[model samples]
Target: MADAAPPLQRLKGAMDAILVADVFLVMAGAAWFGVAVLCHSQKIEAPLQLFQTLWEPLFTPAIGLLMAAALLSGLLGWWQRRGQKRAPGTGS
Candidate 1:
């Protein structure tokens, strides 16, 4: 097993990349919304229109993906820890 990559290393790497992308999308969407709010308050209509146009298609999915990722990560970590607690050779 020395030469082989650790099991799920590639999966973990992919998940890491996806999670990073998801985080960035969520943050970018949030910043865009903030900018839109500022623009709307200042009567700058262009960005407000852009934000509204992108809201349903892009930002919504990004937000959902972030929420799902967070929940899944938490649940998986909890399950992993629970399994470890029952692992062989650990205290009864």
Candidate 2:
């Protein structure tokens, strides 16, 4: 079973990377939304325009990626749990 260690470590590393990306995407989206709300409430046109210029292009794709990552992470966790349940000598 020692030979299996590297692949398992790689899988964990990949999962960690994906989770980090998911978190970053969420934070970015939240920050963008907060900026938008602040801009609207403050009636700041120049900053609003600048934010829109940068955010509009990436907003939809970023949301989509965040959602996809969330789903993938959930599925991966579920799959791991299922595998663990099925492993030999592991009781319910």
Candidate 3:
């Protein structure tokens, strides 16, 4: 039917979802690490070990991917806006 979105729109929507998920994971991991640091500074052990457990498997890759995703999203948005700004008669 005519209700379906274009393929590009669908792809962009999926990319946005991935970007949000990456951002959430990175933020949650960083927050957990912060809490672990505070616990260590106070000579307590609330989530020090748990945070370490997540550092390698979850946090590390998520942090790296989040940076890449953010860069891609920024560039994609910029490219889209710039293209939209261009007109048939404009040349600059």
Q: Considering every candidate listed, which one attains the maximal lDDT?
A: 1
Instruction: State the lDDT at 6 in candidate 2.
Output: 88
Candidate 1 stretches with Cα past 4 Å from truth are: 1-7, 88-92
Write one digit per residue (lDDT tens) for candidate 1, span 1-92: 35866769978998899889989988988888899899899999999899899989988888888899899989999999988988975677
Better of 1 and 3 by TM-score: 1
Model 2, span 1-92: residue lDDT tens? 45656888899888779667767876877786688778889886675566667665765666677778779879989999888878875565
If scored against the real structure, what TM-score would every candidate get? 0.82, 0.56, 0.70
lDDT (0-100) at residue 51 of candidate 3? 87
Each candidate's number of clashing pairs is 0, 0, 0
Task: Give the whole-model CA lDDT for all candidates, comma-separated.
Answer: 0.88, 0.75, 0.85
TM-score of 3: 0.70
C-alpha positional error of residue 66 in candidate 1 after TM-score superposition, expressed in Å: 0.9
User: Which pairs clash (backbone N, Cα, C closer than 3 Å) in model 2?
Assistant: none
Where model 2 places Cα greater than 4 Å from the true spot, the runs are 1-22, 89-92
Q: Could you tell me the lDDT of residue 50 within candidate 3?
A: 82
Candidate 3 segments exceeding 4 Å error:
74-92
